[model samples]
Target: MMRHLRSIMRITWVDKVPSKEVLERTGLPSMEDLLTRKNLRWTGHLMRMSPNRLPNKSIYSQMPSVHRKRGRPRLRFKDTIKRNQKLRDIKTHSLASLSQQRDKWREIVK
Candidate 1:
């Protein structure tokens, strides 16, 4: 989308697009905004789950599945989030409460 928007900007402005300038400078909403919004929404979804709802809860926990024969076990949500994010705690109970604060969780996800 950034590339396409840059292309259109260049064409419409007769080939004078700013180099490495932000989308906001052009008065446009940005991909980063969209992604962060989506992440916040997903974080909210995870935070609002109950253990009885297996799928959402299972995202931060291991699930039973067929084993692979090779390099490593398949990646799951818990593995990815834990590797990239730092938190005071990642246990299921704490995750739910911490994620209740939208801005805080957004920063962690980002």
Candidate 2:
């Protein structure tokens, strides 16, 4: 992504332009930040859904007790959301309440 940005700006590595300067010059955010914001926004949407809805249930549902042979458990969507929330310094306990307010949630996610 940085490569594409640099190309668009007609910059080369030889110019020694830092990625941060490129992003600032283009008035854009980093790819990771964009993804994190999108995920958190979607999570807020899910939080506003009815509890019985499939998407909402899937996120808050309890998993059955079953042992796995895995050395590391696969990351789930919920885990990803939690990580994103932490990155943004959002409190987990307030997620549901905050998300219920669409305008507020949008501001917080940004």
Model number with the top lDDT: 2
Task: Compose the digit string of candidate 2's lDDT tens values, residues 38-61.
Answer: 998899889889989999888888
Query: What are the models' TM-scores?
Result: 0.50, 0.87
Q: Give the candidate number with the greatest TM-score.
A: 2
Off by over 4 Å in 1: 11-37, 64-66, 87-94, 102-110
Over all chains combined, what TM-score does candidate 2 have?
Answer: 0.87
lDDT to native, each model: 0.59, 0.90
Considering summed lDDT, which 10 consecutive residues are worst modelled in model 1? Answer: 81-90
**Candidate 1 lDDT score at position 38:** 64
The digit string of per-residue lDDT tens for model 1 on 72-95 reads 777665554553333324455566
> Number of backbone collisions per candidate, in order?
0, 0
Q: After superposing candidate 2, which stretches have Cα over 4 Å from the reference?
A: none
